[model samples]
Every structure is written in structure tokens, then in C-alpha cells.
Target chain A: MHGDRLLLGPGPSVPYPEALEALTRPVLGHLDPDYLGVISEIGDRLRAVFRTANALTLPVSGTGSAGMEACLVSLLEPGATIIVGVNGYFGERLCEVACRGGAEVVRVEAPWGSPLDPADLLAAQRANPQAALLAVVAAETSTGVRNDVAPLGPELAGTDTLLLVDAVTALGGTPLEVDEWQIDACYSATQKCLGAPPGLAPVTLSPRAVERMRARRTPIQSFYLDLGLLQDYYLASPPTYHHTASSTLAYSLHAGLGRLLAEGLENVWERHARIGAMLQDALPGLGFELIAPERARLPQLTAATLPEGLDEAVLRKRLLTEYGIEVGGGLGAFAGRAWRIGLMGHAATERSVVTLLGAVRQLLG
Target chain B: MHGDRLLLGPGPSVPYPEALEALTRPVLGHLDPDYLGVISEIGDRLRAVFRTANALTLPVSGTGSAGMEACLVSLLEPGATIIVGVNGYFGERLCEVACRGGAEVVRVEAPWGSPLDPADLLAAQRANPQAALLAVVAAETSTGVRNDVAPLGPELAGTDTLLLVDAVTALGGTPLEVDEWQIDACYSATQKCLGAPPGLAPVTLSPRAVERMRARRTPIQSFYLDLGLLQDYYLASPPTYHHTASSTLAYSLHAGLGRLLAEGLENVWERHARIGAMLQDALPGLGFELIAPERARLPQLTAATLPEGLDEAVLRKRLLTEYGIEVGGGLGAFAGRAWRIGLMGHAATERSVVTLLGAVRQLLG
Candidate 1:
């Protein structure tokens, strides 16, 4: 086993103690009655966390990117038009996956470190009034920006367009209401703020999104990600065989969600908000400049430029080797010039912040 | 955590103790240098287990089915012809997924509980000589039959068609030589004979299969399963980030493989064969009829028809509730009639066979 290191990277934040304990439980068959009960409980927990009444809510059997692929492939068919807000790495990825599935993409642009304007996204949807979906990242992990997802949802109400949100880094750490925000679909990763290992992608789809999926003239491009088939296995009586799901991962996620809900969603959000503020508040004093604008920043993840005249890779390597703290390197425009520090889930604590800051101060000196 | 129950199903038999312990180890960043070392070790061990020196061997992030999708979408372009041997549920699934990717499938058929005749597969391939791929299941988990995958590979050696094998139930539990058998692309699940949880699909592709993937005319249909991009992430220096892999699962699989290699592959295979024989030999005495013919039966999975007038579901449930043993129900032709009992990986032991038989005998009385 590798030595324990503080994970302050973009994601895969430190796992909860309960989750780690759950992983050691004896293996259960996917269709076992008791195991199915665990799955049902997980679904219920996901619903409460997503703040949605969608009956189709469940964890997809892959990571966050698989969740993204599932949503795109399930809803978008050939020749369909989608309006995607592109401000960071994930948004660009949305366009790439949509295009591969034969959808025509209309991009709404914003600077890398700035949130996409809700007005611009709605305008794009209006121009392509027949667009099937409008997708935005609720929290952009790449740039630490929180797009204005709430505004776009209300505007798309009763329109042909469905609002799809990427909540990979935003889910349990920030304020997100799938039902209240009128999000047709949302996908999140367990490793982020969910305090579990990175294997499952919890996704919720509204009635309208399911309707669009059923109404598709062409077959879904991916049989594995096809929500229709997955629903048969997850929700059907005497569930049919879909695939051999990882019951071990499900058990771990169940424990993690149980811990989160016990702490209360509002309380969990508050803790993250406070912890994120502490780190963000201290970075500037240490010569690190925050990437996201003040109004658009995400609390769970912070992207900051390193102090001038220090090699980013060299310093990050020292932080890892000497201090055993892992921070993320910048992507796209910030490559080699910035660090992405994540204070999420179990790692979102005052102690972690103090330790990381002290380590950075020592390295910089 | 759920109570411990013996998993005697098609796949996900039971996890090794070492695997369970490994899962409890600290979670690592997906790209951590030490975690990367774990990945590299896994690749080396997988190469040893797969019995091939294929450079593209790596685990896909989803279950065994995702591995199937990866091989199909990676190599077969739209409108490509694929000759698939359809003798069980997974074979039918192969045709379904291939068709979803826009490939025209020509099926070579056999009875549900019977193995596909290698001569018939050869005949189909010869008739459709321009076929891009010829696919078959090395072990048909749905019916407990081991199809002849070795003959087809040598026949297609000089042809343009690639030989794809589904070793989901065959790998590690039985003799499989990818290099000696000339199999081009093969995929298996960690949950089956690999003694790990059902979250990863270990796949190996020969150089010729890689050549066909590179020569694809159109973009691969699924971006998540695109082997070229996955290869870049798994093999490239300064690896590009494709998705957040579960290091926890990798550690579990690594430990499982290590245990298997330490036991020696031939010894592991012999244990499974002996245990399977003990179970099969006792079934007939218990008024059960074996499904697969003697020559085609798989040592890892045994399909048998229960005594007349006994409800299959009730008996299985009794075994679960009264004895805490989980066995599989039949699919396709044997639905509600046959049981698929698997003794795979760590579950393949003389004690397991004796316990299962004792429970069956008691329930029958």
C-alpha cells in the first residue's frame, strides 16, 4: 500500500472513514436482495442530495466522464442541435462528445476563468430555438468557476430545450437544487464532494429528459450508457441483467452518502463554504492569485496562479515529495503557470487548510 | 454492511481477502506517481495473466460489457461487417452493440446450451471474407459452455478479419493463451476469474488489432471507449488526463492478480477444474441434468436443469435465505429451469463445492 498523502488536487478528495470501512465489507452479488436494498437506499439518498423527485435517479457504473457520455448519448440523436456553454475544459469536452454522437453543437463562449453568462446561453438557445438541450457546467473544476445555471433553467422552461448540468465538482459541496433549478438532467462524481472513491457517477434525469430519450427516432449510440436499458435493470421488478455492477463501490458510496445526509445537506454546504473561504482567503497573502472572478468562483475548488519566478512543476513536485501533499497542475491556458487546489468533502477542514498553507509557505521561502 | 453470503453466480464469485484489504488502503490521486506505478504493475500482471505481450493491454473503467463496447467501437466503423457467433445471451448482446455502432452483423448460431461449431464460424467468415471482425465467446457464461476460440484464430490468420474473444468467465479459471491461440482482441471482467470486484474490464489487443483501430475511416462512435485516446492516457509519457480512474479498484485488482500469480496460473486453473468437476459430478446424483455437453462445459461455470416440478426461483431463494448461498438463474432457453453455478477465482475451492452440495441436498429433502 502507498503512504497516506493529503489529496488537494482538483478531485478525488480524501475519502470519509466510513467509506473506507465500507470497502472492506464482504462482496455481495449485484442482484442479491440485501444488496438491492443497499442500491435502493443509495437511490433514495441520491434523490435527497439532488433535491429532485425524479424516479430515474441512480448511479451510473463509471466515473464522471462516463456520466457525461451517458447524458449526451441518451438524449441527443443525429441532426439534433445542442447549445453548450464553453468556458473551461469540461465544456469543450461536452462539444466533442456531442459531435461524436452526430449532434450539431452551438457554443456559447466565456473566458477561461469567467463563468458563462446566463443571458448569452439563453440567447444561443433562442437563436437555435429548436435545440434539444442546453448544457452548462454547474462548477467548472478546470477554472474554479460556477456558471449561472439557475438563470438558464428558468428561461428554458416550457421550451423544447432541456437544461443539462455537469455537477462533477459542485454536487454536495455547493448549493444545487435539481428540482428547484428545473434541471432536466445532472451528473456528479462520487470522489469530489461525495467523500467516496472515484468509480460511480450519480445521475438524475427529469421526466422531460426521459421523455426526450424515449421519443428519439434513432437508437442510442451506446448500449451500455442507454438509460432506457439501465432503467430496466435498476428500477424494474425482478431487475434484468444489465452488467455486473461493482457492489463494493456501491457499499462505499452508500456509507459516504449516509454520512453526508446525517450531517445535513445545508450543514455540509456550510462547512465547504467556510473551508473554501479559509484557503481562498489565505492564498493571496502567500502570493497566489485566484483564477475565477469574485462573483463566479467555486468554493470547493480554487485555481490560482503561482508566485512569479518559481517553476510550477518543480514547486509542485517538492510539495508532493517533501510534504506529501498533492495539488493539481493547471490545464489549457493556465498550464505550467497555475495550481488547482481542491478542499472538498472529507478534506474540507480547517486543519487541512492550515497544514496546506504552512507547507506552501515553507516551500516558497 | 450486509452479511457475508457465498456468491455462486455467473460472475463476481467472491473477492480475495487481499483484494478486500487493498480496497481499505488510502485512496490515491488518479495521476499520482505512486498510483501510476500501481497502474504500471497492473498492466504487467495483466499481460502475464492474458498470456500475451500485447502492448495495449489495460483495464477499461466500466464492467465487462464496457470492455466489449470498447473493442467494438474502437475497431469497427459504421457499415463494417462483423461475423459473430451467437450461442448465448452475451453473443446476442455482441450483435446488439455492434448493430448499435452501425455494423451489419452476420450471426453463426448454435443451441442456447451448446457451443458454436468452429467449422460453422469458419464457414460464415469465409462467406463474408470482407468482414472486419470475427467475434466469439471463449466461455459463454449464460449457458456454461466454452466455445472453440482457438480454431477460428488460426483460420483467420491470413485474412483481414480480426479475432475478438470474450474471456469474461474463462480468464484465470481455465487455460487461455492469447498469443499461442492468436487471439487479436480479448476482454474479461475483474469480478469473475480475476478475484476482484466487478468494476473494471481488463482488455488486451494484439498489434494487428491496433492496426485495424488506427485504420478506421470514421471517428470512433464512443469517445469514452476509444482505445486510441485511452492508449494515450495509459501508455503516453506525461499521460494526458482522459478520466478520473478509481485507484481503489486498481489496488484491489493488483492484489487479486498478485495472489493468483503467486499461486501459479496452472495451479489456479487446476483448482477451478477440480472444484467444478466435484460440483458437476454431484449434480446428476441430486436429480439435476447438465446443460452443456461434456466436451463444451466450462470448468468455471456449471449450468444444470433442476428436477421436474420444482420452482427454480423458490429453490434459489431458499438456498439464499436458509443457507446464505447465492446462485444464478438461467437466461434465454433455460429461463426458470436451469441454474448457473460459478466457482471462479477465490471462490473456486473444494470447501465451496462441498458446502454448496450439502445445502442443495438439504433443500431438496
Candidate 2:
């Protein structure tokens, strides 16, 4: 396992030594005064990363998907109208969770490799004026398409409709101005560009979103994800105890975010952008074509449609066995037709890019 | 943060070096052939510890509460009737999750420190044959009551109703005969007897429960927790991908369970029982009163009612601040009236027992 080195998948990229060290640090009670200090720092740090000064910014105990559910379930009560943007697997999942939470869901469809057209969203607003929330993915990991959250948020701003963003693959790798974009509530996963272990989801809730949660006609539909109660515990001045947090994992995530900040968020983003471009440029030499548009592509995740006569899974296996580098195969509809190469967090290193390019090149050759 | 060890109340117990070392092991893709081998081994090991040969068993990538949700949501759909045994916080939580998942929940109530009665459960079943499930906690960590699961499980068996058990604190600390007791489904956390870090819940579904899931009218309430879709990925014969598993944690859990088996399950259970009794016997001299009856006490967790006029929290703080040992303060109505001492999983050592007793005695003096 030693030489296994870093994980270069779209999610749960290899944790740095600091993150791993945090995991090994002595345990702390979730509500201990000393641990509350760490939790307070974490809240401040998440706000900085989330770019939200929203009072309710915090991390949920589950993974990135939990953050998504937290945002959706808390805002949309049973039988509430919500418009969900669907471009890939995760967006489809958002619709499912929203429906399960008892929302009268309406889908605004987009192709996998393309970003959502804002006009379509505006039209949905026109059609469903009673819609209480608009949920969209900022970075669609399944397709490597980064949606333009900046404009969508502002367009939906003046209205009472809250904006929920899934930044699972977008955070740290790119700019997410939660405040500037006017994101009502947005969720991100630690496993992505944070280069930490999975188990925590960083989420931010705007004042408007908080009000909506308070005004819920029915309970959030899931106790594990009820944001009202969770925020009361995570965002209080001294912080209240809600659940026994995975304190060890929380510490590891804090360390990972520390390293992310020390490297400087902008520079980290640039490094991923540069390395992702290198991989993108090199893949064509091996007969692979880009699955997403250049402007819409996420720097941390590059989706490549498999070339004719090549099997996506076999290529992924060959990369792992022959090169000792792990990459992800396509998910959902892209299965066997595409490969997802993640340059996330610590795995965003130039060396990882070179190793992955070498593996794909050799396998195709 | 080196000496930052926490008095983790009841859970997220201080793990051993082996468990921490397992976490730092190299990450593996959840679908990695090597990882699958480890997963299979872990499944078998859990089945052995659970004392059942149930083919469907694996860890869900959430906390103890998620395990509760998985067992309930998978079997009981909206409008279904179920009888829940509530003597503590977690049992009441089960009632809530059941309600959220849309079950018409009825509770068989018991006071804190008192074990749930089998007669009360039998009467509930006779009263409500429409009830599709009976949920109970084998070890109520919140109140320190160990119920008669052996009789309660059989009392609900053979009918259209299923038996669901929550064994988060009981798994490694006591003997659980799933087949012998006819438990339709059971879920437990890793931080307990398995000695793994917090995160990931091991759960098993009996053949009867699986049939119930298969017969569900609507998809299980939550997509992330839909065991039907997840079992495909976990089962070896027809392999599939469910979710991005926490590879590092899985490795850690596998390593921990391996060690648990090597120690021999029965011996481990007996060791905890012996230590618990020894510690309980020493408490009367310290002005602490036994809250749980001797016949129905939990070996892994002991609740001691604080002496009148003695502050339970201050004494707990004294143990942690002065001696660097953590004991749990009371929860719910028991707050300020009791302290919980846990001898569980890897922490069930004679050294832990001796250290805890000594610390308590010193605090009392």
C-alpha cells in the first residue's frame, strides 16, 4: 500500500500528509471547549472557501451528497414547488432527493457535456412562478461541465426563489463566490479538490435560506439532514452539540483546507487548470476526444469520450495495473463511452498528469 | 494536538494504534479488484461476529443513525405500521426516522436505566397485527439498558412483521445471535466492538428482510440508502458499483474486524462482561448508585446515577482534565444525574477498566 501513493480520481483524491496526520491526531469530543475552537475555526475557514459570510455556513456529517440533500431538504418542504437543473447523474439525483423530500419537482434539462441555458431556467420560473427553490450543480462532475453560477444566481436573486448549488467538483479548483453569486445555499464535498478523505460536506446557507428553513410547513423530511437543527449545533457562537461528529475526519478536512489556503486558492486553481490542459492536449495524441467544451470544462476533472473500438473499463484497469495510477471510468450514460481523469486536490500534481497521460498513451499504443 | 485526546462521551472512542495505522493505508478504489477482496473478507468477518451466515451484510458509508435509517426505510414504506421500543434517545430517534420514512410508528415505552420488557412487546404485537416491523435496541447506550432481544426478536418472528435490531454498542461487547434470535435486520456502528474509527455502519439483512425490500411498492425513501441498488455492488456473484466508498475507512474496518476475530468473539464478550461487573462493584464505595439492574445491564456501557448534590459533569471534567481519561456525561433527562463509562471494542482492555475505576475513585475522593 505504501507505493500506492496518491489517488487521482474525480473524488476523494489522495489526502496530503497533513490531512492524514490530522486523522491520526488524538480524538476530541465534538462539544469539547478545545474541539469547539477547532470547529469555530473550521466554520470561519468554510465561509472563506464558500465565499459566504452567511451565518449558517458549516459542514454536514456525511459526504458531498449529504450537503446537497441538506440544502434541498431544508429549503423545500413537502409538496413545495422546485425547479431542478438536470445535466448529468448528480442533477438527476438532486431531483430524486427533492422528490423524496416531497417537492413538486420540475426538471430543466441539459445535455451531459453542456451547461444549462439560463433562458430555460427563466422560462421555468415563468411557468412555475410558485416554485420555492431553484437547484443547480455548479460543477457537474459527471460531465466535466462547469455551469455559470454567476449569472444564474443573480437572475433568480430578486425573487423569493432560493438558489441551491452543488459545488462538489467546483470548490477550490475554481472560483465560487457564494456571496457574489448570491447563492442561497451551496454544498461541497471534502473528497474533491480539498484532497481530504470522504465523510464531510461543507455547506453554506444564506439568510434567506435560513428563513425558508424556519418557515417550513412540514419537517425537512429527513431527520439526518434537517439543516435547521444541524445549523443550530454547528453555527452557534460556541456551537451546540447535535450529533457525535466524526471529529477525526473533521480535523483532517481542516488540515486539508489549511494546506489548500497556504498554497493560495487562486494558484491551486491555476495549477489544476494548467495540468488539466496538459492532459487534455495529450489525450488527442492517443485518439481520445474531449467530452466537454473548453470553456465549460472543469480544470480538476476532464471527461474524455472513449475512442471507437476501445473499452473504457479495460483502459481504466490497464492504467491501474500497468501504471499504478487510478482513474475513473464513465458513469451512467457515459459508461464505456468515456473516461473521467480527475486532477483533484493533492492528486492535481503535474506528476500525476504526466503519469496518467503516459498510461493512456501506452495503453492506446 | 498530540495530547488532544478527547473524553468522547460514549462514542468515537479512543482508537488503538492499529486502527489509526489502518486509516493511513493507501487508498483503493471501491471497485478495485483488490478492494473488493477486502470488502468480501470484511463481509464474512462481520457475519461471523454477528453469529449469522446471512449472505447480505456490509457497511453503509454513514454514521450510526444512518444504519438506523437504512434498516427502517428499506423495509417499511409510507403508511406501514411498526412497533418501536423506546427507553432512550436512540430509540426515540428510531421512531422519528421511521416517521420520516413514513411509518405509522407506535412505541413500547420504558424509563431510562430500565430494559424494555418482552411482555410489553408481545402485547403490542397482539394488539397490532397490521404492524410490519418491530424495532428495538439490543444495547441502549443512551440509558445503559440491555434489553431482552432474544425474546423480543422471536416474539415478532413468523408473522408478516419483521424484526429490526440496533446493535451499535452491543456488537463487539456482547454476544449477538442473529439467526438464533431470528432478527430480520440489524445495523451497528464501527467505532464500537469492531474497534474501527467513527464512520461506516455494518448492517445485515436476513433473507426474509431482503424479500421484503424486493417486495417494496415504492423505491426506498432515500436513493443513497437504497440497499437494493447498493447490494448489487457488494455481492460478489454479480458485481456492480453502488457509490464511491470510503476506501481508507474500509481498509481500517477490515483490519479492525480481523483483529476482533483473532481475539475470538466469545472471549472478547466475556472480557467486557467481567470488566463491567468489576467496575460496577467498585462504584458503590465511590457514592455512585447503579442505575441499571444487574440482570439487564449492558457490559459495554454502564450508567451510574450521581450522588445527590454531586455534580456529574464536574466529576467527568475532573477525570478528563486531571487524569486525561474521558467518561460520558448523562444525556436527556439523565443529565447532571449520571455518568456513562464505556468498556468497548479495543478499549475493553483490562488496562482501560483499571484506569477508569482508578480515575473514578480519585474523582470521588
Candidate 3:
């Protein structure tokens, strides 16, 4: 009766059993030839997944938040002028990390369920022409709006300002052209659409980003997140090991990315869109309302408002406790207003979509 | 004949099968009651392992290097003065990370295979009395020199300067008295003597360190290594889930730390000592010379000068290819001359020690 259960959470979703097995594989030294071979494969996969020819593509040995920290701090040195696009909880978080890095941050604001217009962000950049870096979230998981970074970077074209992005939830489930978009430094986590366990963060640096880091007036204020030294470890010849990456994690990410590549990136995105469509269409029938505007929605994720009288916390508890189905309630500004349902990786399936809808329908009945 | 050959490297050593098995255990959500309980228990065990009564003990979701960055960057602000003890490769690394945090670094030099004489370091501190922090490695794994951090702080007692210690190779294998020594901030990794695979770093900070961070005029420049926000995330009532922890990595570390605790910290350290003693005593018989003075020696690790006429790299190659054993060659100052034999974690069994001794003997003949 119970072989496996579908994972339908905002994140920390279920991984393929093969990915789980990758965690148990015999641990090898970080610098061992066999492990380096695995790491080399990881770099290629990270580049393909990031969709960049950037030579600095590799995993940062930390979690999703670490990814955010690495990208922001390494790209913008202390006192560097930057514009942070704050639309959701994650964007606000970017502002915090950027502020901590001693950047003079100018926040380009859009309220929680709304996406910032790329044109407005460009206007702010023009007004604050001293801004050397522009940061945005390609997929704002907190509010379920997939900001289009591709067109946004074009407006910053011909300017020395580098475009950085957080693609933590969008890599496999959504189409992101890092090169085509002219995004400078981008980082992502393994837990979302990759279906790998959470730990390592994949990151890339455009030549412009690397060049600016070299020319920075101040050292990248973090040694660990300093891409300057990290480049020595991850991108240098002989591939000097920086941090001890649990080689086991790279194995799982390798396996997860393998599955995604086999499935074809386009098909993976299409699958997410279809499953998201199914859930989005069915949730309204169960008396739920989608949070973000339909046009700007992320295909792999959905944020829905609870029915007028239903207790959001109570229903979330009941879903986890009674049904073993997991989901995320609203975060930060949207607290008590929206439930985030993710159709990431192995969780993006017709069965999962139908089952979650069925479970909510019965609960509503 | 078919059993897996043992790993006796500097780190990522062969973990016990049980430890590897823990990695495959189904991962629960970061906030799952069961997972949180395990994380809490690991914290308790780490405090015991670190011999710290500090209230801020917890694991950072990164490697030992991350632990290093977490400790250094948390309280260090732009323009802070820090004195770093640089003896070998890792100490130089510490200086680099600290300098990147915008600290004016004063190097307290100790020769490779020699401990940082407390008197010399004290003189440096007295000269730089306004230094905000003092950083030293208790166990300098690069040179197999275990410095006495025990007395490094006594001279600066009652001063405002915080004592920072890196016990990456010392935490579970050597004597570390964080409370008795008045260490304000200390960080350790999981892979070295802890018997866990390398992934997360368990760090502890005294109230003084927290107070320092709280009073910082500038923000902790590195966001990934920022301890202030991480403290709120790890210690918040009903822990705020910031990043999805590698639940299995945490679980495996819990199991390793649990087993280490059950065996008792004193006994686990004694085990490393006894096995290391066997390797150290047998080195002369293999025509290898011990590097560090007996009194300054790290009992869990032995650095031996390669035999004349033997290319250390050649021997290491044969050892890994033939015996499936991996040991470290010297880095930086000692490179091409010495080999580092580690009796770390589950790899420190008497049988493995005797086996390695015998292998070196055979190769020598």
C-alpha cells in the first residue's frame, strides 16, 4: 500500500532513490582522482544546468542560502553601488546579504505577489548610474513569481554594471539563458528542481563579473565566498580543492542532473508547466485562489490563497499530520495569506498533481 | 581479499559502515521534529566534544573551511586588527581569510613542525594590544604540529581581545578546553578526527564573541559565513528554517558524534594516541625520520621525512594504487620531503595502524 509518497512542498521535496543512494556511496578524498573525475563531471553539469560557457561554473560547498551569500558578497565589494530588486521574501533577503557585504544598496521595490517591471529596474539603474551591480531573482520561490532576467539584463547592456541572479528554484524547471541574458554571477541550490539533497550550491561567473572582481577597490570581503580565491580552488588548472565538498553530494547532484539531461531540459520545463497547470486549475475548484498574477507565475511552483474561512495553519498541519502531504505557508510579507505548492523535480507529476488536488477536494468536502 | 581497503588520508577517511548507512536514512524536513531533535543532540554532543560550555554551539552547514570563515568573519569587521599565528599551510590560510575580512593582520610566525610558543605570540599581542582578535590553530594538521592553545589566552586574560581557535583536526581527537582556556570563538569540521564525512562544521562561540558581533560598527562582510543571522536561524524559538540542511549529513555526524560520545571523548582521543604511537615508533624502522619534536608532536598525526632516494610522490602513488590507502604528502614548506600519516576517526584502528606500518616496511625493503 505504501511504496513511495509524492512530495508536494515549497521545497525539501522528495529526491529519486538513485540520488539518495548517491549519498551512501563510498566517500573519497576531496582531491582523489576518482572524486576529481566526479567533480569534473559536476562542473560540466553545473554549466549545462546554468546554461553558461563560463569556466568558473562549480558548486559552492554550502546550502541555498550560502549560494545567495556567495553570489552577492563576491560580486559586490564593500561600498560598491548596487540595486537590489526586492519583490518577495528572497529578494528582501538579497538586500540583507548585500547590506551585510557593505554594499550601498538601493532597493527597487515591488510588493509580494507582484513582479518588478524590468523597465523600472533599468530606470533605477540609469538614475543611479554609479551602481556597479544589479541583482535579481529569476525565480522568486517565496512569492511564486518568475522574474524574467533575460530581458532585464539587456537594458543594462553596454554599461559596465554586471547583472547577477539567484536561480535557486528555476534551473531545471524553467528556462534560464545565463549567457543569452548576460547575467554576470549566478548561483543555485541542488534541492529544488535538481532533485538532489540540499547542501552544495552551483555557481557561475561571467567574464565581466570576474573582471570586475579583479578590479574591485576592496577585496571580496569574504574569504570563503570570495570568488577570487574560490576561483583558484574550483576553476584553476589542476583543480585545487578549496573546501571539502562532501563528494557524496556531487554524486547525487550528478545523478539528478543526469536524469534532467536525459529527460531533456525543454521536456523538464514543459512537464513542470503541465503539472503546474493541472494543480493551478484544480485548486480553484477546491475554493483556493492563486497568489501571483497568472501571466508572471512560475511553472514549477504555485502560491494559492486559502478559502475565506479556512484556517491556513490548521489545514497545513492537518495535511502534514493526517495525510503526510507537505506544503509551505506564506513567508514574510505574505504570512497567513498564501500556501506555496512546488512541482519540483520528482514531485512534478500528473499523479502528484491529481493526488494533492484530490486530497484538498476531499478535505474541503 | 575482497574487503574494501582502508582509507588513512588526512580527511574524508573511510567512515564506519554504520556512519555511511546513516547517510542513506530517509531525510526528514529541516524542521521535522525528529530531524530537529537529532540536530539538537548533535549540538549537545559537539559541546561535549569541543569541551565548551558556550551557549552558542551549533553546526554551520558547510565544511571545515566554512567553519574557519564563520569564526573569523562573524566578529571581524572592516578595519579590525587581528593577530594570526602562521606556522604552516593552514595558518597562512587563516591569515588570508582574516585579511579578506578587512582585518590588519599581524603574523605570529612559528616554524613548521614547531608549536607557536605562547611567549612569542604573547609578545605580538602585547605589541598589537588594540587587536580585536587573536587567531591560532590548536592542531596544525599541515605540519602535524599540535600547538598548545591552552596557554595562548592566559596572557591576554581580562583583555577585550577575543581568542579564536581552529580545532578542525583537534576537536574529537585531541585535548580542546574551550571553556577552561577562555576561548571566545572556536570552530571545527566533521571530517578529520570526528569519524564523520566532511560536509558540515560545528562551531561554538562564547558570550564575549557574540557581544563583539552585536557591537560591530560594520556588518560581518561575508554573508555566507555570517554568524549573526545564522544564530537567529539556528537558535530562534521554533528554529527558522533558512537553508535545507543536508539532513543525512547532519544525521551521519550525529551518529558519529554519538558513537564518539559513547566511547567517551577521553577514550576516543586515547585511541588516536595509541594508534599514532604505533605508527610513530615504527617509522624509524622504515628508515623514515620523525619531523616534530616528541613534546610538540600531535599524537593523532605523524609527519615523517621520506627515505633518501625515494620520491615521496612515487611511494604515495604505489600505496594508493596497490593498497588502496591514501595518506597526505606535505604541503607548502614541507612539500616533497615529508608524508603525513593520520590516525583519524574510524580509520585509526590498531589493525590499520599495524597494517600501514607493515606496508611501509615492505616498500622500504
Identify the candidate with maximal lDDT. 1
Better of 1 and 2 by lDDT: 1
Q: Looking at candidate 1, what is the lDDT of residue A300?
A: 93
Tens digits of per-residue lDDT for model 2 on B1-365? 45555343577676656777878777666666777888898899999988899888998878787788878888988999999999998898899989888789989999978989989987898899889899899999887789888987666766777889999989988888999999989999888767788878899999999999999887776766777766887885647655667777788888888888888999889988987788788788777887889899887888888878988778877877887777787878888889888877777767887777777667677
DockQ of each: 0.87, 0.54, 0.54
The residue-by-residue lDDT of candidate 3 on B88-141, one tens digit each, is: 778898998888777799999988888888788788888888998988998888
Candidate 1 — what's its lDDT?
A: 0.93
Which one wins on DockQ? Answer: 1
Arrange candidates, best DockQ first.
Answer: 1, 3, 2
Interface RMSD of candidate 2, in Å, is: 2.0
| Tens digits of per-residue lDDT for model 1, A1-365 | 47688999998999999998999888889899888999999999999999999999999999999999999999999899999999999999999999999999999999999989899998898899999999999999999999989877788997999999999999999999999999999999999999999999999999999998999899999998998888888988889889988889999999999999999999999999999999999999999999999999888999999989889999999998999999999999999999999999999999899999999999988
lDDT of each: 0.93, 0.82, 0.82
Ranking by TM-score: 1, 2, 3
Screening candidate 2 with a backbone cut-off below 3 angstroms (N, C-alpha, C), the clashing residue pairs are none
* Best candidate, TM-score: 1
Evaluate model 3 with DockQ and give the value.
0.54
**Quality of candidate 2's docking, in CAPRI categories?**
medium
Q: Write the per-residue lDDT of candidate 2 for residues A43-89, one digit (tens) a residue.
A: 88888788779988787877787788778877887788999899988
Pitting candidate 1 against candidate 3, the one with the higher TM-score is 1
Each candidate: fraction of true contacts kept?
0.84, 0.40, 0.63
Evaluate candidate 2 by giving its C-alpha RMSD to the native, one decimal: 1.8
Quote the lDDT for A50 in model 1: 96
